[model samples]
Target: MKRVLTEAELKDLLQAQPEWKLQEGKLIREWTFSNFLGSMAFVNRVATIAEEAGHHPDIEIHYNHVVLALISHDAGGITRRDAAMAAKISTELASHTSPKHE
Candidate 1:
């Protein structure tokens, strides 16, 4: 059975996912894009990843900002899986924002 992340575990995870932070007792992260389409595209990509991981997040998307909150209902709190998924999402977001060289 999956287990909830302890304070120590959550701290360690946070060390790796510096871009993510705890907000209102939830693991939260936000990303901003240039336009609505860009935000939608990022949300779609995040949805795909969430589906593949079997872990869904609470998301709030606006014209250029997307906020994600992760928690495990079964575990009744945050878990390592949530942290891992957050890390993956952060990496993808970073790659998406990075300038590409031809």
Candidate 2:
């Protein structure tokens, strides 16, 4: 099973993902898209990634805004898996120009 990330390690990992915020033992990010369709597109992409990695995140969509919070429930907090997923999502976002962070 995956282990929870140590405070130091979490701090370091978060440094590399400046857009992600650590909140309540979860790695969180808020994304703003051009519109509802654009937001749904981003959600679909995230779903594909989650399926590929076998790690899913809690997603909240509000019109043009999408919020993602990732945590390893089995590990009881954020883990390396969460960080890795966040990195993958970040890379995916980098490839798109429609989604601007809010």
Candidate 3:
């Protein structure tokens, strides 16, 4: 079973991931895309990453925005797994292309 992160550890992790925020005990990040296609593409990549990691996040999709929320439900809080997943998602985000304005 994974262990929940202590407050100190969480703080360090958050510092390293400026785009992510801790809210209501979950690690959350939001991405803005130029259109629905861009947003869906990001979501698809996230789905694959989450499947490989075996740590799925709660994802919310709007027309041009996607929000990812990660928490270890079994651990009842954030864990190293969540941090790792967030990092992977961030890495994917860096390589993703924004939708072109037509």
Better of 2 and 3 by lDDT: 2
Return the top candidate by TM-score.
2
Q: What TM-score do all the candidates reach, one by one?
A: 0.88, 0.92, 0.91
lDDT of 2 by residue, 1-102 (tens): 788989899989979998889878789888887889988988998999899999999999999889999999998999889999999999977776354444
Query: What is the C-alpha lDDT profile of model 3 across 1-102, one tens digit per residue?
Result: 789999999999989988789999999888789889989988998889889888899999999988889999999999999999988888876778442221
lDDT of each: 0.82, 0.87, 0.87
User: In model 1, which regions exceed 4 Å deviation?
Assistant: 98-102
Q: Please list the residue runs of candidate 2 whose C-alpha ends up more than 4 Å from where it truly belongs after superposition.
A: 97-102
Residue-level lDDT tens digits of model 1 in 53-99: 89999999878888889988788889888888888887776777522
Clashes of each: 0, 0, 0
lDDT: worst 10-residue window of model 2:
93-102
- Worst lDDT run of 10 residues, candidate 1, spans 93-102
Structure candidate 2, residue pairs in collision: none
Candidate ranking under TM-score, highest first, comes to 2, 3, 1
Q: Candidate 3: lDDT of 20?
A: 86
